[model samples]
Target: MKVGLIGFGKTGRAVASVLLESKKVNLQWVLRKSTTLEHRSVPEFLGVHSDEPGLIYSISEFSADELFEKHPVDVIIDFSSADGVDYYAEAATKRGITVISAISAYPDNKLKLLSEIAEKIPVLHSPNITLGINFLMIAAKILKNIAPYTDIEIIEEHFKSKPEVSGTAKKIAQALDLPDESIKTIRAGGIIGVHEIIFGFPYQVVRLRHESISREAFGNGIIFALENLVGKDNGLYTMEDLLLPYFHLNETEQMFIEKNTKPWWRFW
Candidate 1:
């Protein structure tokens, strides 16, 4: 499998390290721009940086039209910023390449547009790419069935640098069918990430939580997504699709993803 990566930051670097060490995936062009892969280690290319040596791909720029011609790949993984969302979706759809995106904090409309793009290609986007958190989302749906009337809410905290409410919180809320989620966000000093869900009823309360001690939490999920992306049909997939064997979701979360169908014309 040939793979292309964007975003050489923490999670991106870790995932790249694993893929490189695996010796199975061919690292294709590592594009800085979501668009054009036109140069070869040209140095002036905007966002390409490799602290790790012996990478298989050249650091370069890539346009949507030139992607397959330059760096042909079965899959493209993005841990990039929200700005790369549409460009990745557009580029991948053009060549029928599957994209696993862990990019977050974009507006809902952008996500809706990505869903439309998925009708054209296989696109799986997750805000928190930790299998644990994704399982929590499925768990949230289950707990809702057990305590259907409980008042459930999410509280998430990250480092002071983290700008917005976590995408995981929103995922939890969406899993439980809450359009307006009650999610608390706290940004403190150097904290990695902590997420908790509180379900309160007449008798007692249930608290389910997951904490991230390192970026490996994120890497684990990304690698899992990449591994399962092969031989998948074209559609918008979520972590639930990836977690079917290990964790079986019985209700909303299961029926939701499994039954989702988008119109072919919606891709336009």
Candidate 2:
């Protein structure tokens, strides 16, 4: 598969490196705003030593009608901002390229755009792209069902510079059907990310947690999405649907998915 990557941040860099190592993927286009002193050249940015000067251009370098005309891609993997998700989704949808997005949280209106794009092409969106974190969510959901009325709270710790509760924790809240205010966030140290859910009952307490040792987990999740995305028809997909095979789901968990899932646009 040919891939055009968006973003060049920590996860984006990780994804680029993994794509270079993949036997099935051709790591092609990467968007750069500028080649000025502020931005590294393609070779330096992607950690490659290519001599070609024609490579690496920002989204502005190509018009929408000319995006695929000059260079083609089978899928677009995005590890950028929410704006990047909408930007690439529009271009990819026009050219029938599958998109796997691991971008940050987006507003409902932007997400609605994603849902519309999914109507014509496969659009896999995940706020938490780490498989372990997603599995943690699945387990947490099961626990939520087992103790439906139990007092539960989630605590997420991230780098002190990070301003909001990490998306993974919010994703956990979604699984547990808890309100946004139910999450407690700790911004301290240089901690990559740590998510733990505490469930308190009159008789006992239960806790489930997952931590990020490295961003390789995110890259692996992206590849997992790529491997499965090809055979799927046009629609939006999430890690919950992607990783269910590895974990055993009880009747309660299965019913929860059936009940909570609906036409995503319907929420708007």
- Which one is best on lDDT? 2
* Candidate 2, 1-268: lDDT as tens digits: 7787777777777767777666677776677555442334555666665542214567666764476667788888877677776556666788899988887688998889899999999989998888788888888888878878889999999999998667777777877888879999998888888999999999999988889887767878888888877888899999888787667788999999989899889989
Measured by TM-score, the strongest candidate is: 2
Candidate lDDT scores, in order, read: 0.72, 0.78
Q: What's the TM-score of every candidate structure?
A: 0.75, 0.83
Question: Lowest-scoring 10 consecutive residues by lDDT in candidate 1?
Answer: 50-59
Task: Provide the lDDT at 40 for model 2.
Answer: 43
Candidate 2 deviation (Cα RMSD): 9.2
Off by over 4 Å in 2: 37-54, 248-268
TM-score computed on alpha carbons, candidate 2: 0.83
Q: How far does residue 1 in candidate 1 sit from its true spot (Å)?
A: 1.6
Collision count for each candidate, in order: 8, 0
